[model samples]
Target chain A: GQQVMQIPQYQHVQEGEDFTTYCNSSTTLSNIQWYKQRPGGHPVFLIQLVKSGEVKKQKRLTFQFGEAKKNSSLHITATQTTDVGTYFCAAHGGTSYGKLTFGQGTILTVHP
Target chain B: EPEVTQTPSHQVTQMGQEVILRCVPISNHLYFYWYRQILGQKVEFLVSFYNNEISEKSEIFDDQFSVERPDGSNFTLKIRSTKLEDSAMYFCASSAAVLAKNIQYFGAGTRLSVL
Candidate 1:
């Protein structure tokens, strides 16, 4: 079994402030994926990191995978009110048949 | 863009009753999955289906739970005897087979409340 841990269960940031969330896994991960779930909505796929020390960005959001491949991070710059939601990091092992184990998630609240 | 669809946005049932949640995955996707999220919690994987058979299932998908692809378009999860613990939001997701990274697209979910 694989365990994924995320830090800062809750985060409150003023609009235009920056926010970051970290995710660590108990075992080596083949790949890590990030998702965003809005209030009363299902999880939406944001991006996935496959290579070690990989960094990808989507607009104001930047996603990074640790060099060891067991950790990852998501940083949002100049957050807007629309960034209010929960960000989750999920991963699956090499043998898993597409079964994704998700982290507890970081709840982000952007105050206007 | 196509999307996964779920039926009955909300369902309420009594304890010991049987309930079925239905989902229609993206037509072109080859893998289908079901997950549950207790309010304010992370999404937990339940089962994964491919080629009309279950490829993998988690411990939570025990004897009380079963999945079936009765038709080409519908995938269903049935709880034989529901308990209060079964109350959660059930989400169905689908991913394309061509990609190595299975990016699952989830449906809005069906909130089940067991009284």
Candidate 2:
């Protein structure tokens, strides 16, 4: 069975601070996707990285996929009150079609 | 922008009663899935449905669980006999296709509580 692990289960920061969450997988993945779940809301897709050693950015958020395709990271340049939510990284293996193995999310708390 | 929609934002039932959770996935999507999350826990996959049949299911989706696509738009998950442990937020998600490049869109989940 494949498992995805995320580091820093919880984080707290003031506005204008930077935050980063790391995700690692026990098996190599075909692609990795990042999602954000607002408090009491459904998970929303943010970005996806399919190529090895790939990087993508959306405004203040930067996402990277490792060269080995076994890990990924999401970094926020400056935290805002609106960024308070749980960030999850999901991986799909070569044989898993669209089924995703999600990591234990990193809960980010941004204080104004 | 179309989004997945789920019915009965919250449900309450007895321990041994049966319950059905309903979802209407995005119209153009081809893949459907069910996931559950306990309070303060990670979301766990339950089953995946495509072409009016189940394609994949997790151990949690045992004899007590079943899925149905009765029509072109509705996908439902039925629990034969609910238990206290069955309380959680159940989410329905859909993807345009079964490719690594496709991203899933999730609906606001149905919260179920078994007393």
Candidate 3:
């Protein structure tokens, strides 16, 4: 079994502040995916990281994969009230096609 | 934009009763999956289906749980005997192809309350 650990289970920040959450895996991951779930909604695909040390940005959000491929991070710059939600980092270990092991998720609350 | 759609946004069942959760994945997607999340908890993978068969399943998917693609468009998860611990939000997801590279799109999820 694989395990994904996420840091800062909860975070509350001013609308203009920055936020970062880290995900760590006990076993090496083939690829990592990021998902966001709003207050009563389902998980929505945010981004995926495949290459080691990969960095991708979507407007104010930035995602990074560690060089070892065992960890990843998501950073949000200048968060807004609409950014309130739970962000989860998921990965598929071994050869388990689409069986994603998800981290506990970081619940972010942006206060205006 | 196309998305996964699940039926009956909420379900209430009694322990030992049978329950079925339905989902309609994206038309062109090749991979379908089921995941569950307890209130305010992380999403947990239950099973993944491809080409009309299960590709992978987690330990949580035991004999009490089953999956079926009854038709070209419908994917369903059945709990033979629901238990109190089975209460959770079940999500249906789909991916285009090559699970390693593609992103999975999730449905709104069905909140199951087993009493």
Candidate 4:
């Protein structure tokens, strides 16, 4: 079975602080997707990385995919209270079709 | 903006009882999935449904678990004999395109508690 491991299971950051979370998969992935789940809410899609060694940004958030396509990272600059949530990296196209293997997730807590 | 809808936001059942979690995916979506999350634990994938059949399933989906598209608008997951470990939040997700490239929209989830 393929496994996706995430680092810094929990993060506590003050307002305007920067935060970064890393994710690694046991197997290479064709594409990796990032999702955020706010407190007491469902997971919402954020962004997806498809190419090897690709970098994409959404406002203050930056996402990077490793050259091998087996690792990824998400960095947030100047965190805000609304950034408090659990971030998960989901992988697809390793050995299954129409299926996604999600990492354990990194919970981010931004304090004002 | 379409959303996946789930019924019975919470369910309480005795051990060994049967339970069914229902979901209504986005109208134009073609792929469906079921995942579960224990309190304070990671989300675990259960199964993926496509083309009126199961395309993939995790080891956790055994004979005790079954999924069915009973109608044009309904997808159901049935647990034959529930156990304490089955207590968790079950989420139903759907995507408009092939999974590898499409994003899945998840429901609020159904919290199942087995006493």
What Cα-based lDDT does every candidate model obtain? 0.94, 0.94, 0.94, 0.92
Q: Cα miss at B16, model 1 (Å)?
A: 0.7
Tens-digit per-residue lDDT, B38-106, candidate 3: 998999999999988898888899999999999889999999999999999999999897558878899
Q: Report the poorest 10 consecutive residues by lDDT, candidate 2 chain B.
A: B39-48
Give model 4's docking category: medium
Report model 2's interface C-alpha RMSD after superposition on the true interface residues.
Answer: 0.9
In model 1, the clashing pairs are none
Off by over 4 Å in 3: none
Using TM-score as the measure, the top candidate is: 2
The 10 consecutive residues of candidate 3 chain B with the worst lDDT sum are B95-104
Q: Candidate 3, DockQ to 2 decimals?
A: 0.82
| DockQ of candidate 1 (2 decimals) | 0.72
B-chain TM-scores per prediction: 0.96, 0.99, 0.98, 0.98
The collision pairs in model 4 are none
Compared to the true structure, candidate 4 yields what TM-score?
0.97
Using TM-score as the measure, name the better of candidate 1 and candidate 3: 1
After superposition, candidate 2 runs with Cα above 4 Å error: none
- Estimate the overall C-alpha local distance difference test score of candidate 4: 0.92
Query: After superposition on all CA atoms, how large is the RMSD of candidate 4?
Result: 1.0
lDDT of 1 by residue, B1-115 (tens): 8999999899999999999999999998889999999998899999998888899999999999999999889999999999999999999999886244778999999999999
